[model samples]
Target chain A: MDNLKIERTKSTPYIFFDAASGRLRVEGESYPENVVKFYTPVLDWLHGYFAEGADNITLEFKVAYFNSSTSKVFMTIFDLLEEYVTTGRMIEVVWICDRDNDVSIECGEEFKEEVEQLSFRIEAC
Target chain B: MNIRSLYLEEEAVLKRAEGLLMSQQCFSLDVYRELYEEYRKLLKQMKTLVNVADLTQAELKTLSEELGKVSRIDGLTELYNRRYFREIFLHTWQQAVEEKDILSLLMIDIDYFKKYNDTYGHLQGDECLKAVAAEFQRAVGHPEDFVARFGGEEFVILLPHSDAEAAIDVAKRLLQNIENLCMEHSASPFGQRVTISVGIACRCPTSDVKPNTLLDEADQALYKAKAAGRNCFKLYV
Candidate 1:
């Protein structure tokens, strides 16, 4: 699988997925006007990576503000990672936010609570 | 998966469960139990996704409304800012033209504002501006009257459905209110205290008249007021 990199815009976040290192990073605010249109390629890329029988992957999210649609998309992402972990694959998810951002912290905590197999951590920077 | 595909996949899972139920007699108990368990897990995940989307959407909507209100108001004096004034004033003017009703405008300027700022500093100047703005709000009691901070050391008031006589009365009341504030302005030449100059313009707006003409007329009157004296009102012909 090849690495994927999508630049951030005023409305959408930056996405960087490294196939060699198994490191994925999403940064910036995510409030795209068309959430599905913006996220379809990213989801397709993830599907390709997982189908290649990837052994270990680490995903980090440093999002500032995300609308409700993006929140649902994140849920979908978490479900995919959890599916891989159940199949004996090593998958790690990290949520990074500012210490003073109560909303972001709460969101990360809620995601951590819902996941069963994915190793998740919330880090304040 | 994307939102559309995610929902489609959920529907497909449900159809698979339905298909298994239709061929129930053909399947062994262990196989049927495993299929049912998988169906239940998929349903649970779908439920979680919908719930999170709904909750976050409601939160973002409220935040967006609050930001809309904040954008319309001036940060310092809590009065309507120039941008909002420009929008609403145009709307009000259009309404006046349609109804053939009189519209009055007031352009107000603080006398010796630069001197006052030099003596008391910017912090106190801001306080003085806030105090004057508060007095304007109090002096204009009519529901039809609109007040806004035009810019630094300048303010504007719109009096709808009011003629020149009524507008003049409002101007007199405003002058008295500011004089009563008695916020000492040692730097001013007018009575050794803060004072304002007022310019009034009234028109029964017509569709043919440009909207900015009223503003220009009031500004001219304000110039005349400043020329006559530091603390007085002038009416445009």
Candidate 2:
């Protein structure tokens, strides 16, 4: 599978998903003008990656802020991770938040609860 | 004079005065006094009307100004509003193009907001929107970045000299922040958590393309995100 690279914008984040290392990293503030358009390719890439039966996926999310709409996209990513984990592939999600932001910490917790199979960690960055 | 006779006499005197005035004869000082009194009374009434008209005009001007202020403000989030957004967007876009800087936009919407509003009361839904708006404001920290509550549960963030990568980082942070809020809505299909969908559009502003086109592209990206799922970010190619 080819690597997935997304350039960030003022209203969105940069996404780098490496198929070989199974490492996916997203970093930036996200409040896109159009949420679906920004996230679709990422979602499609994830779908294709999972279909390829990738192993040992490490997804790191370093976000400063995302609007409610972007939260839904995060959920989709988590859902994909969960699917991979259920299929016996190892999945790790690292959620990075600012040290003082209680909000990001809680967001990580929410994802942790939703995806049962994937290992989720909340880190202060 | 007797009271009745005095009234008649007064009437007769008034008639005589009228006759004298009609004949252009010299009038009594008393008659002149009476005419002056009548003139004064008429002048007083006219003066009152004029004062009332002036006050009414002043009040109207004040009301019009207040209305203008209200209309200028964004109704939903009470932000600087969309009218201001257009002015700033054009200026920022122009500046970016001239400086050869990247201008990025994020169009965001509350995921399943309509459903959320339907399930919870509009009051609760409004609270959700307020919380989201506050989160967006915090995310776009740069002085040059313009964040406006565009409409409904949607918002737009404009970042000047910001590339796609920088915007994505901001978007991710915002996504994580809202998740942390832990506001529960059981009715949400996305689980107890409330989420959003974002669309990102970035380019060096150019003479050929208007800012609205960039916004439209971002909006298109957002639609793709929604189509794929309730939560996520999609970027315009």
Candidate 3:
């Protein structure tokens, strides 16, 4: 599978779903005009990755702010990772937040509580 | 000469009509003609008024359209508003059902909000709400996710192509982010720190599950979170 890289804009975030390194990194703020229209392709890529049997993935979320629509997309990514973990593959989620920002830390903790097999950790940057 | 003659002619006609009505004791053709002319004049005046009314109606419609464009807030809290959320939710739900993608929802609420409002006034309470809202907006990080301010101090996040466990994880992260804020809420039931409770629900777009039902399930989980504690999250069974 080919690597996917999306640059961040005023209205969107930076997305890097790398196939070779098995690292999916999403950074920046996301509040696009049409969120569903923007994320359909990203969801497709995740589906394609799973179908191709790519294992040993690490997902990193380094976001300052995003809209409710983006939250749903993050759920989709985590769900995919959960499936892979269920199949006996290792999946790790690294949640990065600023040191003083309790909001980000709390959000990371929330995501961690939901998943069972996937390893989840929160890091302050 | 012309003005004098015209005035004299009108007066003569009026006099003749009165005379005919009195002497003939019957309605004449000339009287009918004069009445018809008066009726035509009134009709023309009414037509002009009607045209002005139509113009005012058109102007009002244009003003309303302009106001809608300027006054409507598409997204609040840096997330989608209820209006945008409903549109995307329906669209994504349909697509996920058709394509067999994972779909999920998370309902989030501020813990001890009433206490917060009591301790810090509604102004500060609103500030806290805005801060948390910004955090939720940042969490999704993708276009596919839908985050919306469901109501005061409450938010809903939609995750497509996700499962139950992942949805739970996201909820946990949101809780952690808010907790880390350390926004002092002395009146809170959960201690000095302000926190949130989240409820999560996920579906694979099965034939049995509808979008509203999924939301209801998530809301139930949110209720469970509130029941268990003010700062925890739960996933629907």
Candidate 4:
């Protein structure tokens, strides 16, 4: 599976997935006009990575702000990872939040609570 | 990966899902339960997202208001800056005209401030300016009165409903306050202690009279005050 790389915009986040290292990173704001259209390639890359029999991967999320549609996309991504975890794959999810932004920290905590099987950790910086 | 190809692939998946939902006649009890749980989780996430956005919006509003106030204030003296003063001065002038009240402007300068800076160094000169600014702030008791840093070593006070006599009383009070401070200004020819020169201009503003007219008159009076001698005030006749 080829790695996915997309630059960030004023209302979107930067996406980078490394096939060689099995590391994925999505950072910055996410409020794109068409949320589903923007994240389609990212969802495709994740599906392909898991289908290619990848055993372990680390996903990092450093999002400052995101709209409701972006929230739904995040829930979908979490469901995908949880499915892989239930199939006996190790997936580590790290959510990085700003220390001063209580909202971002709270959102990360909410996501962590929703996923049981996946190793989801919230970190503040 | 080609983005177009990936987008097409996801579109196909979405179409398939739509078809599955359309064709499905009934779902098993376990499937229904799982869907209900997912719906609840989504609702909870949605609530958090909305709350986060609201808080961020409110925080941004407060930050912008604070930035506005900071921009209008002088950093060293904590007085209204010249630009902001100019904006509000016009409003004050208009209000005085509408009310048919006397408006007075006092142009004040520190006597031989350059010499003070040279003798005591820039740091002490800054302290002197701050002290004088504080004294001016304390002396202006009226709620409608405004004090501003007109520029380097110069300050202006706007007095509403005051005539020449009232303006002179304010000048006297300011001079007395500076004397109480008793700041040493060895290089000043005016006196051993720091003193200020004030120029007073009073008028009942009219619609035809521009706001700048009063300001110019005050400036001219300040020049006369300096020429006559420092450390005292002179009223524009």
Candidate 5:
């Protein structure tokens, strides 16, 4: 499968998906002017990559802050990951948060609880 | 693996996916690839559209709060308007109680301002308002100090951690600043220059005492300053 790389913008996160290495990363803030317009193509690439399944994969999320709109989009992404885990895919999802931002830490924990199927870890970096 | 290997292998994956080559998989790789491409576009678009509608509902909650703030500023003085003044006054009063901080309120009025407006015309009255507002804004150097245009010819200054002494000092300096500007007011009462009257009230505010308690005291003191012949300040007893 092809790799996907999206550059960071002021209101959106940096996204990188590598099918060969089985690694996915989203880093930076996420509160796009139009969340749908910004995340559509990237999620499309992710769906395609997930279909071409690998045995083991990990997605790293290091988001400083995200609006509620962006969180819903993230819930979709995590739910997709959770589906793969339920189907016996080895998926380890890591959410890295800054120490000062307790809200980010709490959000990661909430996602972990919500997506019970995926192996989720909230690490304060 | 290290990031370099991951990146290099990604380039290799792109090479294969680019060639339109079919890999060994569960079923017809060509058919699966075509189906995945077709399904990916629709699936993502559908998911995102559903979420977008849900997001706007939540986004509107925060949007209204921001709009409230933007609308709370006075157009002429570029200072907070009366509504936000009351909001912040309550907020600061609450903070003072929580942190055991001193809070002070200053009610300022331009002496014989109606006469100044009548003598100099409304345009110059507007110019005077802007200049005075700017000067007061400049004088309050602390980031937390709150200032608002209370109404015509009146402004409020809130100093959240200051005592009566500090408030008096600020009032004195503001008087000196206006005196130095020497804006002409040939109407009547005071001298040839425009002057101001200030009233101050300070306390470690608590719920036992309302935000209005200090405002009323400051207003009373302002009245006293006006009665004591207009160009000075009085502290609430």
Candidate 6:
């Protein structure tokens, strides 16, 4: 499997997925003008990898700010992770939030509560 | 496994990627082609969606601009309101002091306006105020000159980089403009028509003075104009 590296822009976040090492990460602010357009390929790649039946997956997130549309996309990704874990696959999610920003901390906590199948941890930075 | 830059969405490039992934392990060539084709269809759909988003963002920008303009305007006079006037004058005062340039202010009021409002009803009084405000708005000649509705029956004009002479010219033009309109005010002593009293103040702004100082000087001059009899302009010395 190949590693996926997408560069960050003013509106979109950086994505670095090392499929071989099983370390996937998304970092930076995400308020893209076209949320669905920006993230469709990312979902496609993740689904492709999942088809091969992964043993263990660790997804890390370091998001500063995101809008309503981007939140919907994040929920979709969480749904995929839930599906993966339900099949007895080991999936760990690490969501990073700045200590001073309560909104982001709340978002991470909500994700933890909502996605039951995955082991989700909120790490304050 | 090779690292790939993921922005590229060409069909040929995606097909090659699918070939590489299929070569890795279990995916057959036919299955890989189907996956690649599906991805290509998704990219085309995203392009269409992005075009729609661009239109929505443009409309949002226009709406915000209109809202900002509305906030800065006085609804009755259709001129810049007191808050916007104060915000701009403070900055202009600072700039004038830094550059050591001249600044002028004109504080104007309608003669016997309270009596006029009493005699003609508040509705007609509002119409008279609107007409007078339009005259003052027309008298402002330069882009740097601004006129604002200061309060009931009072208006203020700010002229940046204007000397005493230029300000007097503006005052004269404002008097002529209002006179030409010939708005009726039966309660006025100045004339049969509504007329305005103006007080002019000018300063080569310095670090020691503030915006309120200019306003106070103009107010004192306006009092002097009233004492000297209405329908005339007084310059603060």
Tens digits of per-residue lDDT, candidate 4, B18-76, equal 66589877767776675566556656656655765676667668889999999999999
Worst 10 residues of 2 chain B by lDDT: B1-10
Could you tell me the TM-score of chain B in model 1? Answer: 0.88
Model 3 chain B is weakest, by summed lDDT over 10 consecutive residues, at B1-10
Question: Per-residue lDDT of A1-125 in model 2, one digit per residue for the tens?
Answer: 89999898887888999899898999998888877777777877888888787888889999876765566566556655776688799889999988877656666665566556679999986
Candidate 3 chain A worst ten-residue window by lDDT? A67-76
Top-scoring candidate (lDDT): 1
lDDT of 5 by residue, B33-150 (tens): 8656645643554455455445444556677987886899999999999999998898889989899899899999998899999999999999999988887887685798888999
Instruction: Write one digit per residue (lDDT tens) for candidate 3, span B46-115.
Output: 4433443344455558779977654434333555667767777888989988898988999998988988
Candidate achieving the largest TM-score: 4
Q: Give the better candidate number (5 or 6) by lDDT.
A: 6
Better of 5 and 6 by TM-score: 6
Candidate 2 residue-wise lDDT, B182-219, digit = tens: 77877677767899899999998889986789999999
Superposed Cα deviation of residue B47, candidate 1 (Å): 3.4
Off by over 4 Å in 3: A1-125, B1-76
Instruction: List ranges where model 1 is wrong by over 4 Å.
Output: A1-12, A15-24, A30-58, A66-73, A87-90, A99-102, B1-8, B14-39, B118-123
Task: Evaluate every candidate with DockQ and list the scores.
Answer: 0.30, 0.00, 0.00, 0.26, 0.03, 0.03
Q: Which model scores highest in DockQ?
A: 1
What are the per-candidate TM-scores when only chain A is compared? Answer: 0.97, 0.93, 0.92, 0.97, 0.94, 0.95
Fnat of all models, as shown:
0.23, 0.00, 0.00, 0.15, 0.00, 0.00
Candidate 2 docks with a DockQ of 0.00
Give the Cα lDDT of each candidate. Answer: 0.87, 0.78, 0.76, 0.85, 0.81, 0.83
- What fraction of the native interface does candidate 2 get right in terms of contacts? 0.00
Candidate 4 Cα deviation (angstroms), residue B19:
11
Ranking by TM-score: 4, 1, 6, 5, 2, 3
lDDT of 1 by residue, A1-125 (tens): 88899999998999999999999999999989888888888888988998998878989999988876687688788888898899999999999999987667777877787688899999998
Give the docking tier of candidate 1.
acceptable
